[model samples]
Target chain A: MEQVYKRTKGIRDDMVSGFCPGCMHGTVFKLIGEVLEELDILEKTVTVQGVGCCGLAMEYVTYDCTTSPHGRACAVATGVKRTNPDRLVYTYQGDGDLASIGLAETMSAANRGENFTVIFVNNGIYGMTGGQMAPTTLIGMKATTAPAGRDPKVHGYPMHMCEILNQLTAPCYLERTSCNTPANVRKTKKAIKKAFQNQLDGKGFSMVEIVTSCPTNWGLDPMASLDFLEEKMLKEFPLGVIRDKSREEEAV
Target chain B: MARKFMKGCEAIAEAAVRSGCRFFAGYPITPQNEIPEYFARRLPEVGGVFVQGESEVASINMVYGAAQTGTRAMTSSSSCGISLKSEGISFCASARIPMVYCNVQRGGPGIGAIQPAQQDYFQATRASGNGGFRMLVFAPATVQEAVDMTYEAFDYAQRDRNPVLILADGVLGTIMEPVELPPMRPEEEVKALKEALSDWTLTGHRAEEKALILPGGWAGQEDRCRRNANMYETWGKDVQVEEYETEDAEVILTAYGICGRIARSAVRLLRKEGMKAGLIRPKTVSPYPYESFDRLNYGKVKAILSVEMSIPAQMVQDVELAVKDRCRIRTCLRSGGEIMSREDVLKAARELV
Candidate 1:
């Protein structure tokens, strides 16, 4: 018998993940694990996860990691990267964690160009706390908090993190990705790898924002959530690499 | 290093370097400003890193991250800044990361004043963060004491795998005095110290027993906090206090930080006046010297006077706990950046006698 594929060494073998069925966290986690294992930096990396679902990485990741206080993963990662420059460090954050409560830390880390990677999962809702409206929630989307759908006059518009970060001069890479399709999943993994590679190369802050689906919160099945994602979420958070210094010369 | 005259905050920073603190993250605030300033200039020279973070919350989180890597890390802030840092401090406690920090305390209760005030004693010893976690807090009365305590705090934090605090006031922070500084820790020694912590310190993914548990190594919140409570119980053996001339005295003067120093002087003045006055000063305010008060002969001591710069008398609550009302407790206090005067303490001791 020929073994084509097996589990990634990047995730712990003894533990089962707590991600909800149809949640993209499982898919994104698999991608990050595959990328870490492929790069062979599993033993050389330290991860800081912000509060919310992203914090689950602290339990399942094969590498040593810490779950910082809500919204401070970027600051914690900044500490790790600045002090242990030899160690590969990254932060996995949610939209609520990064854009809402931790905007100061995220913006400061990005502006300072701290040499680290950020895996931002923007699922348009705070999944861990029971589907509250998130900073990335679509204007017309109804969350637990915004029962009648997000009103622009009251709740404000969804934040485009990649574009916001693109305004900063220090970022080495800024990309928005998704996991709604196999090709998009591959691109998300590639974006994560590039973000990690930027850190290994001693480049400044790099962020790969993954526009994901939350089936339970979206009130739809996993497949239907993908349909809503492509039909709505993509329109607001368009997928693309907002900035890549590596392609500066080519673009110019 | 030889005895050198230096500002209290700057000397504390230098002492941290000598003690092998290789990482510092802090924000700018009064009195403690010299600490970040000194680190900003000196840390790079010693191959250490210094960051003037966007805020105290961010700065302490940075220290938390750095300390996870087995690095000797620290952060310092003033009263209101320390209030802002409480969130990160609680996080570090939750994670059980070893690090040191100092509060060159200013007036509090919503930025009450920028000058030194002893108003944060309750905040420091009671609820630095919400987790019921305890830190070994050192109350230094002089520049020399501040330098010495800051120097030794790192080793204590590393040994217990807990955070330690140097509680100083603006007067101690701004005063220039000569200190017999400790010898500079060798770079190799610092490296080895960090390496020795590799068993627990975050160093990337390791397939080992330590790597198996959740971060902070607890089963749940109750289990985590209960374990820390157990560790704190053992710290009863580590309480440090200075009891002076209390064998047989009619009045016992008790205080901490600058107020303690003033109380000591008041003792001298009371002695010169032929009044039987003694002093009980707690060097470690957290593991407070409760036993010191137990050792006092209540039959001989008629009154215990609590002197502090906090108007409502924060540390006096501890003094009462220490005395347990066996002796009458009195307080001579100042607040909002007003340093307690030896004369006021002297008069209060005379009244108590």
Candidate 2:
């Protein structure tokens, strides 16, 4: 039997093999493209990718893509969405890009309830510039920036973005999902689809924070990275729907 | 067809509306707050969008977003606010997004004062941010000119695919003058003009043809820089200035924007005192109206006094470069938000004469 899978309409043919072996970013990107393709809104979608390893996301996914300065993806997306309200706009940001430098832009955009979607990729460490200590880096995680492990006294604790972003009343959808196992990966895809669907329904400011694995940055092979995410990362950052306005009666 | 007495800020807002601008995003600042306030009240009546952005940075970014969709969009602020807006301005310039920005200038190296000053001349005409890009800078002298130029700014920005600046000062922003509103252009004509530029705009792509791709980052870095520089060079050809009795005058008063208005008043007073003083008011500061000064008798003109509201910071260098050893030059200015009065300028001219 043939494997039932196909690339999204805007996915570049040449960028097919650039992803590291078993990288969750590739899976998440493909899932986002699939969601857009399913909704038939890929043609009018503009994705603003944040600065980090995920910053280069525009190169792979082929819809009208724009890259903003580190942590400013949401602000740029706000501009795109407000100007072209007819078009669907979204931002894809990593932990460092969203939780650190871009926290202000993200928070403000969410608070304003800008009509856009944000796909937040929360890997434990900063994967782009040699595995630095990210705001989402869990306690005792051994990465390049925190070789002695993350210290709450010095660097603070791992940030729960889904939990934090959920507290705000503006966002229509806020969920935390994982990509460490096949079942969880399916659940992550469902959450990603739901976020995009919220934008389609004209619900404002949806975000799906996917707890993904960074094998290269985690100093592990593909399987070990998945194991790390399942055993440690998920334990530190729990997986659940933190906020879903679509489930509320008032949202309807 | 309606004639009304209006402040410079109000005129700018009215002109923008008359020109079919439907999107305005701005943060309130002294002198220029009137522009935003006017738009906030007026825009909704005409089915336009007016957003009071979180900050000047957010406002400009909002304009950038709106302009990308091929809508006529604008933002207005003062010196400190404009300083916050430079990054978005540079982005719009690089992206070739058409938008209007009104800088109601105030005194400042920082937040110097909220009163009138022309200290932002260099900032407006020169590189406002980190890039080799030039915005179409129009220095409006009177409240009437501020209104007219603001309407013209939208046309110029779309025609040249660049950002346009209406460089007014606090005096012009606050002062009142009679302004005859121009006849409104048909919306279809404005839409046609925007559609004509669709070859380069992000207005969705046709099937089987590649979309007009804009570089997002330093993806093709050097090539992008060269392309932006060439666009600046091509657009710089339309620099303009107004020459007043410059032919036989012995001294030239070189000023621009609101400074030019004050200098004109002072020039009249100097003429009454029997001195052959003339005024050279640059309308386009970025292109600097270099050719206008080239026609003057540089050797015969005793000196060129560069009068401004800043510490003679901007026009001084331009005057020095233009007259270069052909004549003596002096700078008279009143900074820190203080408007240099006609009496003060005449006093300075009398001493020099």
Candidate 3:
């Protein structure tokens, strides 16, 4: 029988993935590669990979790519996108890289409506650093730094990046999605595709925040992590389109 | 090609533009605010881009991004702000992307003052950032020299695939001087220069070849470090120094940046008094003019008076390293915002004699 599916050319054939089993980063990265391939802009794309597990993309992506200093990917992408306006630039960042250390870089870029895309992977814990509490860590989630489970009194509330950025008028599109199920994974891909399309269309900032799981970091089996994600993670970061500038433009 | 009166910061910015610098990302800081302000007004006129980044950290990283595109990019900040940029600068150097930046220095161990001081000599030459990476740090004393160094900095950066620093002080950044501005490079020439770097730069296309860059944290860096060491060695030969009447002088004054400019006057004053004195000034402080120190008539020169704005004498350490106890070394003092007086330098020289 003819093969019904195959790996997208967006990923490097020699790509060596070091992602842990049950980690959703593999799924999210595949979606980005596939979306860039589907959009037929693979050759014109440059990936700005942040530190953490997300930095693993630096190893696998076939596109011209560079890793920025931890938390500076957004700012770096701003420079690349501005100077090479004809090129498609996007930054792939995790919770610690984005919402923690790089929050100002992200917010300032979003506020300026930089014509680029951001792939924000919010797994609620810092996985590569052995599961320290991330900005998106749930109120009661246990991390290496919050061994007794996160306490809001001391750790503050888990940050909702999409909701926080939604206050800015600059971002053209902001959406949150997950890859727990096949259907949710497909939705995540769609969200990612739309974000890229907005950038290609010269629309302002577009972001697809992927609510994901860190099974190893959470000290749970991959499948159990999904259960926990759905039960608790989604409550703090409900997945849906946060804003669509196209809809507002159509109304205008 | 004709001389024009210009302020140091604005002159450097304009010279950078003429030198084919098509991208600038900087935040406002004292003494260097005119750089970003000038770029904001000038870059768009030349079809270039300028971003007033949210912070110096963001600003330097923005330059990092622009450098990936092989565009001549730059950023500027003062003392503490430079400390913030050191992280991004180190990344740029590690990634081996060519870019230029300027430090219109203010006095500081920590935000010491808004006035000019040569207090960052060590930071500029030794520890610009983490990672033991060194730059061809140009300490231009006069506004005209600042303009010339800023103009040529981008090419040196591209040639070495390294970040270059124009280490200026507030005295230079704020002063106005007449300068023969470098001719503006044609726009097409700038494009061609940027395109020539496509083989290694991040052009964002894979039809030919994909370029992957790992900043600072890449494995197999021993080879890169070796390559950088070779480059630093080459810079030793290229070190530029001006030795005024060191042929038969007993007291030679040593300094860089504004102090160097002042020492030149002191040399003339000492000559008027029939005291054999000379000046040795290093134009580039990183691959410092150690050879110039060797050329000093150790047989005749009894002392090297190190003049600087920093009290504890930062540049004197380099002087000591260069002189290596061959001659008596005395420090002429100032700190924070205080500029050196020629009389202080002469007093220290006479005492040394």
List per-model TM-scores for chain B: 0.96, 0.94, 0.98
* lDDT value, residue A181 of candidate 3: 88
TM-scores for all candidates?
Answer: 0.97, 0.94, 0.98
Query: Per-residue lDDT of A96-117 in model 2, one digit per residue for the tens?
Result: 9899987878888898888899
Q: What is the DockQ of candidate 3?
A: 0.81
Question: Comparing candidate 1 with candidate 2, which one achieves the higher DockQ?
Answer: 1
Question: Model 2: residues >4 Å from true position, as ranges?
Answer: A1-3, A142-149, A250-252, B197-200, B206-219
Task: State each candidate's clash count.
Answer: 0, 0, 0
Measured against the true chain A, the candidates' chain A TM-scores are 0.96, 0.95, 0.97
Compute the lDDT of residue B332 as modeled in candidate 1: 93
What DockQ values do the models have? 0.66, 0.44, 0.81
Better model by TM-score, 2 or 3?
3
- Lowest summed lDDT across 10 adjacent residues in model 1 chain B is found at B209-218
Model 1's chain B yields a TM-score of 0.96
Rank by lDDT, descending?
3, 1, 2
Over B119-167, each residue of candidate 1 has an lDDT whose tens digit, in order, gives: 8998899999886799999999889999889999999999888899999
lDDT of 1 at A36: 84
Q: How many backbone clashes does candidate 1 have?
A: 0
The most accurate candidate by DockQ is: 3
